[model samples]
Target: MSMLGVAAVIGVTIATFTTCGVGLAHGTGTWCALPLVWFIGFPLAITNALIVGLPLAFLFCKLRLTRWWQFAVTGFICATPVWMELAEPFTSVRWAQFGLYDSLNCFGSGLAGGLAYWWISQKVGIRRGTDEIAP
Candidate 1:
């Protein structure tokens, strides 16, 4: 859970920097945008992690699918609903307004977050059976 939160922070940070880079390059006051983005993005990422990521993680562990790619794919999949909400494809008429760029942002967040969670879990020695004594 905590690792997921860390991942969320990482994802939000990456997406914010990427999205704000143009303004930053132009010397605009985009630095303030990070907090706002984090405010929105962090909760959303955490919610997704809890609502979607936890189940997927449990499934993966049960299935012995703990590979890095599997976690990455899980992250990408988990981020999909959030992307859909942000994109508003069904509610909006011209959905192209928030298309590829937004997608890349959200998906990138998911990927980064997922990988981060996996890395953190590994570093913390939280793998299945790691805590069990050898028979």
Candidate 2:
């Protein structure tokens, strides 16, 4: 990779960390939840991006359906399982009433993440397969 590519990566990494850190701080319970947000949260972000985000993007790119709406709906479906399955036990404060709101939260978050990936890929000049190597 070129020096400019390395610099761009460093900048994006810092920006992502700062964005996520500030978001975590503003969401209440900065005391106890902050640590979990860093440890569990960052890992989950990496996991979702790699596991779910990469494949989804590949499918979209392969199918030539890289529209924003495609990203949103694909993201929503990919993330629905995490919210419905993994996040259920934590909604104890108002368990019965939390699903409606948290469901949206989870889906929106996924959509945003997908859009971010697409935007970043555009900004960074990445293309998959043949276009990635061809002039």
* CA RMSD, predictions in order: 4.2, 7.0
For residues 17-61, write the lDDT of model 1, one tens digit per residue: 776675456564434346667578889999989888888777766
Candidate 2's residue-wise lDDT over 37-133, tens digit each?
4465455545655666666666766676655566556755666666666467763764454444445445655666655555566577655433543
What are the models' TM-scores?
A: 0.76, 0.58
Off by over 4 Å in 2: 1-35, 89-94, 126-135
RMSD of 2: 7.0
Assess candidate 1 and give its TM-score to the true structure: 0.76
Question: Candidate 2, after superposition: displacement of residue 52 in Å?
Answer: 2.2
Task: Tell me the lDDT of candidate 1.
Answer: 0.74
Error of 2 at 26 (Å): 15
